[model samples]
Target: MIREKSKERLVISEFFKPFLRILQIFSCYSPVPASSTAYKMYSVVEVTLLIFVPCFLKTVDVLQSFTELDEALATLLIYVTFFIYTLKSISLITQKDDVRKLVRCLDLDIFQPRNTRQRNFIKGQILTSKGILTLFTAGGCFTCTLLDLQPLLINRQERNGPINFWYPVVNTTKSPAYEIAYAYESIVSITHAFTHCVLDAINIICMAFIIGQLHSIEDTLINLRSYAEKEVNIKGEPNTTEKIHVQMNILLIECVSKHRALRRFANDLNKIYTNNFFLILANCMLALAFLMYKMSKAATLDFTFIFMIFYFGTMMTLVFMCNWYGNEIIYKSGNLHTAAYSMDWPGTPISFQKNLLFTIIHLQVPIKLYALNFFLLCLESYISVVKTSWSYFVMLTTVSNN
Candidate 1:
């Protein structure tokens, strides 16, 4: 048993290593590596670029004569989203202890997959979702970077850098200064993309873990009848009715406790991510609206139009994944009551039957992920967001045309 437990832990750790490495780079308090002097130095530099570059650009937009208000607002939205994620990462770091405690609570033998089929199913689900999201993120970053550098590559005499910012130097177009600024912007952009990808990946991973737990619980409940029978038998001798009753009562008590613990785990997980999910949903909707407006205004074959389409698609896909997985948790949890009902409870003691009845009633409500307790994260909410964004975009386009 000990060896199997150790192996299970090792396998889980191996599965999480890639995400943990990414988290360590972007988060100060991740368990993979705690804060060090070098990490702090790197954090300082990254944070500065993330926060200052956007502010500088906004300021330049305000000062420049030909700057478009909508474009400036779009840029501001992007930076604000980044800023919110940065703060979210810092908040997660401070709650590392709580996160560790939650994980420990979930580290139960019952949660492990029971067979090769179950194990492979969980592995495949996680890998396939992560792979798709990673590919989309990487592709978006590549396309955006290429577009940003298109001016410099196509027109050698182009004076403007890839991104517009208010530099202290007067001759930002000249050599040395231009090269330095270009390098700085490129580094900042790439780092920002990396941070975005890591944070998004972490969200998906958390959802996957929750879904896995739900699956484990379902499996345990499905086999509870045989487990109870085994508990009542002693040394190949059939137990008395009273003895079986007592043993079954004990088994039901343990199952109830496990159920409560799983609920608490889900609640803690929800609390940690509630605000972050809310912000992501809210920001994605606004960005989608803005992107639609930009796309509608751009020429048919313009680079801006093409880029907006890709950006919009990425945002929609991400929001959909989050909602889809969140809804799955609710869907699977709702089935637990049915599983409990299906258990072979005939001829059981009245007390055992009562306990099973209570379990059924409790699970009817189903566990859910909520955003700030205001909106439940589900497919319905995802659909509403899409509709709202489109309505907003249409309104903006109508006003612009007039």
Candidate 2:
């Protein structure tokens, strides 16, 4: 009976279970109901020991060898990447209430489907989100495994472990010490990979949901007249024409309210993530520039070369997907105005016309996600960042050759 009751109450969040499980293992976050006091403390300890401590040690190691620009640069890349991941994890924990609200909003009545068609539409989005998450998580884990396994495949005398992080009071070069360090780094590397994949997946899935909602709204708006007529017919209300107009007004009000809710959701999303996105963009561009420089200098297709190839691909995908979904949001929201205009509004009551006219006017501006208010996240920005990274790579190669 308990199991049956639980199954009956399951909501759309079942689609996100994989992502949440990954996050739980990484100690980044879990849903509010599951975030008990012990889990919170474990999250703190795991993040500090596995992420923050290594980051600090790496920073110290880099500073001690600051004059060796090339060596320091190589280590700096790892440090910067880990720093960004740690910051994102900490930020999510600190803003748990806002994130909880956002997640809870997903299960709200307004977001639920009203008919079979709507249910199918949302299910499609859920499937797409899951597919993307699976591919991304697999790719990420593969890349991290390749990087970590390089040490095992190489000669013992030449191995430097998975990462170049410094450990205090621990000689990472000796036998037992090296084995312990290797295991620790492997765990940390996998955690880092999963954290990036799952956190980014959360944001991507949220945008997917918003896109689904927008399409649902468009369909509702386009079919407003038919829906109104159906309701009027079923109710068998007197003054059928008057009842249709009344139904249209009620439906339009609901659409408008949902539109407003979506805007708020987007706003909250930006407020929490704008700065992080900006930092991530900057980090990707910088890392891509350095990776290109190194790849260009490689004389053979060695492990370093292959590793960089995978790393480079991961960064490119991250940037591209962020912009791709942001662009989708903009495009879908902009079409709302057109959807509103096509609702067969000619014979509707004056009040319905007025409400729809206001809706069309408001939606005209469209929606956009910005990175630190500097630039919009879209294909154009992605192209610009790639071009800029290429220029930097060119300059570095020229300088090195001279």
Candidate 3:
């Protein structure tokens, strides 16, 4: 158990080690799904076989019946959804440790109130970097959903011609029945896409934070290690005080060393969040789009299929979000531990960090990598926008051709 008391006479080990240990718990999980590594391989194999067997049967059973077709399709959706979901889970485990190690590397102390300016700087960096990124991704997902669903609704209105049938539900006619019947379903699809997108965005936001945290950790560790090595060489003669100093220096070094490995695990967690979240959203939308175009094309009077997709989507999203939050609590707690461990250096004023950025850019951040990743992420997002634009253009062309 790690304590978060300011008055607590700053035990650096108590603070840093415990929290770090707790965080590693999330990073180390095998992608294979079971608690045991021995059966882990078997678990993956079993899942693969199970999914494959059904898919194989489906291939053979394609001509069986609509029931078979429906079941097979749903199974495929489930398989893809869970498979990607697992990868995301694994990635997050890896990302969070990367962050923790980087932080341990920087060795920021949450328990010590020293370095007020530096503390604020790092805090600002975290909020703006991760928080803002999260918000941006969330907004983008929402906008995409609205735009995608608009086409569906517009098409519904076009094919149906008029809203007259809905006006006379009790005395309905097939003439305008198709459009009116699907209204409910279309509304559902719109809501479902909207819901799923938000969740997906949130997942990405988590990853972005994990990335930022990693940057912070790495900066701290490198500087502290260099400072420790310099101390031993400076102290010349072998005496009791020098020996004690050496031992403490070694302890600090070990903390950074041990932390490096554990933090890598933390970073893995963030990666999982980014990849899994997007995959979930994309897969769900694809499945919904297919159903809307196929099964709901005729007999359906309103948008029932869209609604079902949205309804299930909202429920699933909440479940995944809760899972992420559960894991993060361990990470934040671990960080608190690392901060306590670094408090042993009483002479080192915490304020040394505000100058840290000016003192050393590498320790402050890998600006080159930051710029590269940020640009790459933005480019990927832009590509999606372009793809959507082209898709819209093609649809317009085909409609004109028809």
Candidate 4:
């Protein structure tokens, strides 16, 4: 029965499992449900459409002189951003086995909630973050769909398709063909939104789990100190002192091992996602700038303007969440050294103190998430991104005026 319970905790909770399914559908990768040949086939087809369709349509638009320079640039930004996502998805699929191992490491029973308080806290955090992401994604999809269909609904007299998709039909502006194109574009837009949401959620959840690990480590250190205090306070025989010392040393060793494992887990995650994060950072800046320019130049409150606003907001929120949680990891990790220092060390022998000192020094560096080993993911980097986006926006505006 104990073994069964341990296995159960090792599995992801039912509440969070659907997110994994969505990720698999969109990215062709999942930590659970391990990838198979069928999955690979499906992923290749889905990713090819997701990446190629937009680029093909935009290329046609540019060749046909169907869009202004600003509009074309904005469309190109979407194509490039989704291309980056495709590359990341390919990386994730290729490294699916390693990702599975990382997920399993995180799912170990030792990391599971030990009491009601902890269980509630973990569930609350997971639910809140998941709920927020789900709601935002739904809203974005709705907005995108509305934007796509608004023209059809608002203008019954004029027959025009929603998106500028390249159809094989020579005259797509006709009734049935136009409607078909509109429906196709709407579906594609929603699927694109769903893809973005799932990918971003995967990164967010990983950071949340790491933060939970940091909390667990801090709690273990506290419990170790309490155990040592109790051992010292108890009025025992003289020989008990050496035994208590030995017990404390054993506990410290276990703590150190756990800490080392956590560090390794973090490093592995960084290695897997670093390039993806860098791509997100680069895409966010360009998308924000292009979108802002298009929105500013718009003369009327059309679907495109409203959609751009939501799109811009979504990008900003994603960037902020990534940096916020990443900074939290760094902050929580730095506290591990403090936790070590606060332990009941004075009563212990010098050899034990040396071990603790080594642990402290090792932890002082703090765990950080970096993008391609060049840009660190933190609130400061987020601020810089916003500043850079603004600078680009200004430059674009100045050139447009001239």
How does model 4 fare in lDDT?
A: 0.72
Q: Please give the distance, in angstroms, between residue 147's alpha carbon in candidate 3 and its true position after superposition.
A: 4.1
Error of 3 at 258 (Å): 5.9
Sort all candidates by TM-score, best to worst: 2, 4, 1, 3
Q: Residue 242 of model 1: what lDDT? A: 66
User: Which runs of model 4 end up more than 4 angstroms from their true locations?
Assistant: 1-16, 30-45, 62-67, 109-125, 153-162, 227-244, 299-303
**TM-score list, all predictions:** 0.84, 0.91, 0.34, 0.85
Tens digits of per-residue lDDT for model 4, 1-402: 011122235344455467667767776566555568887777777767765675577567656653566656755656655566666667776777776677667666556653344455555656667877887688667766766776767665666554566665567778677777777777777777777667667667777777766776676566665564454555353546676677677767766776677788789888888887888788888888888888888656777677777778878877888898899999999899898888767878899888888888887888899988889999999999999999998998987788
lDDT of 1 at 250: 65
Q: Is candidate 2 or candidate 3 better by TM-score?
A: 2
Candidate 2 achieves a global lDDT of 0.78
How do the residues 14-130 of candidate 3 rate in per-residue lDDT, one tens digit apiece?
323323342233232332333576455664554343333333433443333336434444334333443444454445444654444343433444323223332343344445534
* Worst lDDT 10-window in candidate 2: 1-10
**Candidate 1 lDDT for residue 396:** 79
What's the true lDDT of residue 313 in model 2?
A: 86
Stretches > 4 Å off in candidate 3: 1-122, 129-183, 201-206, 225-251, 254-261, 267-402
Q: lDDT values of the candidates? A: 0.68, 0.78, 0.38, 0.72
| Candidate 4 clash pair list | none
Better of 3 and 4 by lDDT: 4
Q: Tens-digit lDDT track for model 2 on 1-402? A: 001111233266667777777777767666765667888788788878877887787778777766754665677666667777777777776676776677777787677665566666777876887787778777888888987988777665775878767777888888898888888888889878878778888777877888888887888889888887776766666747787888888888888888888888888888877876786688788888888887887656888778888888888888888888889999999999999998889977788888989989988877788899777988998998899999988887777777
| Better candidate number, 1 or 3, judged by lDDT | 1
